[model samples]
Target: RITESQNGWCWQGPVEVVWSNPPAQAGSPRVPAVGLHSTTALLQVTVEDFEVVCKGLYRALRIREKYMQQSLQRFPRTPSQYLRAIEGEVWRASDTGPGTFKHLEGFPLCLAEDLGYHVQMKDGVVYIYGDKAAADRNEPKDLPYPSLERFMDDMNFLLALIAQGPVKTYAHRRLKFLSSKFQVHEMLNEMEEIKELKNNPHRDFYNCRKVDTHIHAAACMNQKHLLRFIKKSYCLDADRVVYDAKGKQLTLKQLFQQLNLHPYDLTVDSLDVHAGRQTFQRFDKFNDKYNPVGASELRDLYLKTENAIGGEYFATIIKEVGSDLEDAKYQHAEPRLSIYGRSAEEWPKLASWFSEHRVYSSNMKWMIQVPRIYDVFRSKNFLPHFGKMLENIFVPVFEATVNPRAHKELSVFLRHITGFDSVDDESKHSGHMFSTKSPKPEQWTSEKNPSYTYYVYYMYANILVLNNLRRSGTLLATQTLLGRKRSPVLQYLYFLAQIPIAMSPLSNNSLFLEYAKNPLPDFHQKGLMVSLSTDDPMQFHYTKVQCELMPSCCPSLGLGLRGPRFSGKPADAGPPLGQPLEQRGLCRQKPLAANTACGCRSR
Candidate 1:
């Protein structure tokens, strides 16, 4: 006889047992058999060492659960239930979806009446006071605010846990075991799974719901699309004023003349917006690709939101991309728009551009990406301190939430925004290490950039309080893609928590890592929750159907049924209301059933 329990990577770990008894007497109560177990059969470590690792892992899960619960974010019920069971507590059914908000189902597009609350930022987190009186009294509303001290304490503990010798050894072995076990299961059950998939009817890859989780708004369309749009704009608006250079107006034709280029002569090669071998490991070059024909004026005119044309070109490009997705009938995309925290007016201007241009799309959900370029802002004297930058980024959202009627356009725009992303090159090293003694954001006036962790922490901290105030589900920065270099302990934690990752091997191939070196296949086989994404179609893809480009990478990477599965469960930046956030363990079956119900017909 054997007992099995769920392991960290969503697979079963078998516990062996040997019975030392004969048959029981007929019609009599059977005596329990003496149970014997092998010491080396289960854990390869000493019992004390195993217990120590187990305790550390349990505490880590608890830490995440606490943070997520307080922030109104989703924490999978399985781990929560397990934690409760370990503590000998009853698991209530109503507790399964703690982050669920009933109001999201039919959330209004129109502005709501203002609540007239006072919103303020202190220590990088927003606080909502009931009134000026409450602000004077230093009392915030009942919403929970995360303590920086406690967060740093938990962070230090987890950091220490990942570096511990025993924990590292245990996690590494466990991950290897999970990978090997998945390989064995695939060898034994791959045919049966395929057979089951094929037996299901009326569904194929074409009809399956696929989502492009990671894409930028400026480059959402392919080079061909951009080229055609440019030509069409020139043909129609050659005389229309489109740009203002230092208070002088320029039309489409004049702007082209100023840049020494013409739309009629522009080919894809001459467009020169695509990433190539030269851009590899050079993020600067990759970034420069945003400028068409090596001209920043073209980027500013077509790709910027606050240009003389009021971002008409950018909006039209996004609308066309959305229309393509709608035509595909089963595809969706979450495209990120940039929000440089140089001025508070940026939010209102972007919102007005969105509303004015009518950038509405059923197939598209929006996300705001804050670029980690504080040093650039500081060097230009655009910002006095990092704290002011944080204020510019988050304070507007807080005001919109607190007084929707006052900031009508921004309030409406915020409704479509599902999440926030901290975007930057990860390879760059910051000299500063974040800690309790580190300078506060207001005091961070130095020209050097802060560490990556510093940006992530403040972003999460602010988002945490914001979510608690709004009561919505947002996929936070925790679900990042590039975790291959992460410690074994962190990787194991990600597995346990079922964190979703959006991998862009094509984008990674051109800019950072080589395609052959991608860990996507290995992550998928090891049961890490991974999905495919075309990070920037304009730079990396040639196809008009940009979402389809990712699936082509699947076969070369040896992904069969896994490819469709990844497409089905896109890590949505913010799922519109009525789509419950995916949960793990017993709760995962609903979406798994839906994804597989379509069948792996292509595979």
Candidate 2:
């Protein structure tokens, strides 16, 4: 006999049920799909509160999908399909077929002829017009121009949602469920995965391409590597004029004499670039580590890009790092170069440096990192206002995109550049909260620094517009932030959006948090799309294999041999969106068949 009940999907003996809708292609070889096959609603909260949470989450995902599509960035179709189904809309898969790029002599530099578009910056965002007439009429081209007011409204909603008691509790419980679910799955399938991995041929941890998603170009080399480079540079360019002290050019030897130091006497300990106990929870102390032997003169002479020798030494060191990655055959890195918005000319100077040095490596991509030191720049009277600083950071790139031929070097430089990063001390609290009531960027002329969210919103707004214009997408990935205690709503949102997070546990251990305190494992278990990164090898690492050391040392290194396998996952470590598309395969093999749970080719 059958009895009606409030609970759903109870099994009857020897009974079978078929779904009306067929399951989508799994895209991998047949493996037993593990899932919670339940129809009963597991509501931990009141029905009203649960409904509120669901609505908030749906709206949040929609907001992300809207922005991603507007900027031509990638958003996984799985969520989109679910969202569409909820809205009773059909979801069609769009094919972004194999794209191509033009390279000049092995560099991803595409020097297009020209596209005569009038570009101007307003409210800290670049606007493109067809001609002067269009500008006069206040009509810009048909691009996805970001609305600051709308952004502020959305931001405010999210800020409030995260603070809501119901949402927070619901998100915390959900995250806990995901973590427990992942642990159970791991325990049951661990042995089977290992067996599959052993039977697979020609694949192992060493052979897998591991990409260090976040690393600083200035500090890309470790202490020993930097020490070696310093001594070698001193040996080769001792008599070369490498420093300009108020117009008095000093040779490398003379510079060493002025700093009261000898290259021969400098050991890694003496170089003193590594972060130690003193640097823990001290950003200032960590920054001081950029200078060798505690000398800014040495930092300028060696690490800076716009310095006395046109950053020749810096370029050489980066090239050396790239060569090392190339030699390793399966390693890659995206090294960030700083663009302090002291002047718009910084771009041209940097582009010139890049061109003159021919600092191109097949395994290396470049990123431009803007330091949130506008207060420092403004305090020195270097910049008029926050808008000018933003202009210095982004305007030149807009001009290059508008007329590539006019700004050929920067245009080419932009090709090599994959993304932008905002670097700042997160622990420093700001008094201002970003909202519509807050001052516009131009009006933000106070010496006080803006909040982190303020900086991120403006940068994201500009990048959003710029990506639309360039039609070549760039993703914004947060490093070292996700591995900290964050707002539950924000954390859940990150998981839903699958935002790529590059975590540097060792780096965090030295600067902000201890190794045991890092949230990498929790974030990964909750499916936050986390990856391992070596933030600053020079400051945090002792070995030459910097990136490899991070995954190897971390205790909760997810996959056995690969550690954080997400380190090389395409969502986090793929080639730049502008690069020529290779095969649409995650694994480097041809015809990319679906893989087993062990990441081995399924036979």
Candidate 3:
């Protein structure tokens, strides 16, 4: 016989065989038994095979029992428990493999349903569809687990329960924990749910803090729609009084004051209403001042009014009247002229008016009046109201005509009015006042005289003034003293006239030509030379013709022609050729003989 073990290996009965002669054919031949074996050996072999088969079967049975125990353990102990656990699993596992519910198969359906779980049917298998069970199953789902929409719905429902108060303390704790773990949008969704369940019986049990939570969510999301909704419906004046977990309230109004949401001005209004006593008062005062006055006031008082008392009637009233009541105040006064040599009493009455109007005035007006007033003073020689007017009008005008020609004319006019000598006249005579005898022509060539220094300085000053005039375009339409467009020759003569004859010898013809062609009036010549003689030899070494001629050919000599002269006489009365040796007390007179031709008479 053969037997098979669970392992599938076969075992057969042991048998022995031996060789034998036929008994009928050979009576005389010795015969051996056809078969013989030791019974013990055979029995031992059979027992060994049976033992091996039995051991294999026993091992198989042990394995089967282990699997059975594992399967039974998976069965739900209670219907409710199973329903709740499996329902959730089913939903979660619809798109997943059955292996997903390997651990959840026996959970009671009643428990699963009570816990808000449901079964998802797919491919002839029911799957547990809940977040907790699915997580435990550790299996892939056929569809995404916990859809966003479904999650939101759940949150909304939970929030609604919370808002209805009498919330389970444990559930509320769990929700708070979830809130910390979840996103802001999720929290917002929960808040929306709470708002919806306004009439819930258990509302008192829920710690909604809906307004604060919604505001925080809105701030975090910064979503326009959500913010709009919160601002419109949820936020109250009291809600704006936000306090931190530590009990310190933040200054919400100040924080949001700069954010421009003018179209939603109502939000600001709401905030003001809810603001605490101090903040409410402050906001109210601000509002009252800014509120529009009647349209008639705007039309009647402010339009097209030049230099009006205030910005507008409303603005003026606010400045004058409202300022006294409000915390901030403004007052304006006219400029005073203490620096202009005026008595304080002479200041304008307008100063008081300006203060009354609370109009902001500047010193620019005073500056504009100065030049005109100075002109009047010059013409009149004396004004009884001079000191008073000066005191009243002390404004400084920074903006003068930048045109150089205009500036020069202004300066000249100022000098005329003040009876102050022109700068040119002072510079010319500065050298001659210290000298005694006229300098020799040769001595005049030396670079050591005050006259030469004065000449050079004056010429440089003129050039600078002319260059400035040119740049300012004030020179464009300049005319001669005779009131005709100045000829190039006269212009050149005028430029040369500014330089002492001694100095001209050092200037180049090109420079002369440039000056001649320049459109600027010869202001230096016109203003400086009216009384000063041009042909003074002691001051200027050369004759006028020589001075003019030298620049044409002898530019090098011109470079130092204005060098100092060494004379002892006033420049204007010096001899044409400078001092003679006789004038210096170096030679004695010689008597003329009767026969000698007298040089003086001969001439």
User: Highest TM-score among the candidates is held by which one?
Assistant: 2
Considering summed lDDT, which 10 consecutive residues are worst modelled in model 3?
A: 591-600
RMSD of each: 8.9, 7.9, 57.3
> Candidate 2 — which pairs collide?
none
Give a tens-digit lDDT track for model 3, residues 490-599: 22222212211111111111112222432111222221111111111112222332344323212212222222110011122111111221111100001000000000
Ranked by lDDT from best down, the candidates are: 1, 2, 3
Please give, for residues 1-603, the per-residue lDDT of candidate 2 as tens digits: 122346642322111111132463454233344455332244346656755677787778777676666555556555666676677678777411122233323444444556677888888777889888889999997766557687777767776887899989878876777778767866766666566556657776556566666678888898899999999998988999999999999999999999899999999899999888898777788888889999999999889888888899998998898888788777777677789888999999999999889888877777677788899989989988899998988888888877777997877676667666666766667898777777888988999998776787777777767766665523332223332255777777777666556666667667766666667677777777665567564223323223433343222223222322322223333333233322111111100011110011001
TM-score (C-alpha) between model 3 and the true structure? 0.12
Poorly placed runs, candidate 3 (over 4 Å): 1-348, 360-371, 377-382, 385-603
**lDDT by residue for model 1 (1-603), tens:** 112334311111111112234674464444333222333343376556666677788888788777666655556656666667667678775444333222222234545467788988887777889898999999998766556677788888888998988888877876776677566756665565455446547655455555666678888888899999999999999999999999999999999998888899999999999889999878789889999999999999888888988999999998898888788766677677889899999999999999899897777777677788999999999999999999999999888877777887887677677666677766677999888888989999999998776786787778767776666543332255444445778767767766566666677767766655667656766666665566564223323223443333322223222332322223333334222212110011010000110011011
Of the two candidates 1 and 3, the one with more favorable lDDT, higher being better, is 1
Residue 61 in model 2: shift from native, Å?
A: 0.8
